[model samples]
Target: ATASLASQGTANIWSCASCHGDKGEGTQTVPRLAGLAPAYLAKQLHDFSKGTRISDSMAYVAKSLSETQITELANYYGAMSSPSGAQPALKGDLARGEKLALSGDYSKNVPACFTCHGTSGIGVGAQFPGLAAQQPAYIAHQLAMWAGGARHNSPLGLMAGIGKALSDEDRRAVADYLASL
Candidate 1:
């Protein structure tokens, strides 16, 4: 049932694979869902449905799903172990990115990505989804959204604050570095 839902979808909704890609590898600006924590996926779907996280396409698709469907889809995608197909598209300072990931700049008050996201950005749990190998454009876009108050579902506004602290160059640098992981 979950497979059908992911690959075929209902008449009212589009298949998850259409945009997220088969095996959940995801393309540019679309998140790779494979191996993400199931609870994180579910929370994101709920956030999209509730408008707390803004993405028109995701909102529409998430709104169409029932709780059961959401669970199934989340589980289906969460169980996948597909390798990332992402390639860096940004021309940012990889050295700075690496520094930011491993040792955050205290003067800027920006925390290391791995502090919450886990070592190597592999993700810690439901609250901190893996950032390694995510699309650079998508990462940068999300940072912009958080900084601009367009996306505010993060815990205690942590992401919003961090996003605000990162400069455009910083965002690109971090994004490119994470994608390289």
Candidate 2:
């Protein structure tokens, strides 16, 4: 097993919670893991292991994990309920994001987001990760990374293409809307 799962059914050794904290509350630099959309989590693990997605250490760590381990972690994290409710304030362009999420611009040739991301961008399936209320900064970073070809782990294996199609504005808009939800 990977170091990530060293504890297994025990309370010793390093568990994901060692750094991430129980309940997925992250420390500085480490990231929260609970309530992450299952699809998103799976993609990230796949990408890291495949060297498509990366972090200074996670790239190697992810690749080292067995498929079973990856699946277990993904399911564990996804099954945990997310922190509920939207953030305190609104932002500059939610209406535009709402438009794109619900109905795309025929002129722009963009498809409606819900078909793939689900009605609320909450996602569905063994791969799709819920996006209802993820942090905007994190979402924006992923979008930027995906656009730059740094992150290609996707539930349907289509994020690279999707990222390619989305402009910076569109990414921002959709990400904003997801955060709103």
Model 1 agreement with the true structure over 1-181: per-residue lDDT tens digits:
8898898887899999999988898888899999999999999999998888999999999999999999988888999995878877899799999998999888999888889999999998899999999989999889999999889999898899889999999999999999998
Question: TM-score of predicted model 2?
Answer: 0.72
Clashing pairs in 2: 37-129, 37-130, 39-127, 39-128, 39-129, 49-63
Pairs of residues clashing in candidate 1: none
Cα TM-score per model: 0.98, 0.72
How many pairs collide in each candidate, listed in order?
Answer: 0, 6
lDDT of each: 0.91, 0.65
Error of 2 at 35 (Å): 3.7
Q: Candidate 1: where are CA atoms >4 Å away?
A: none
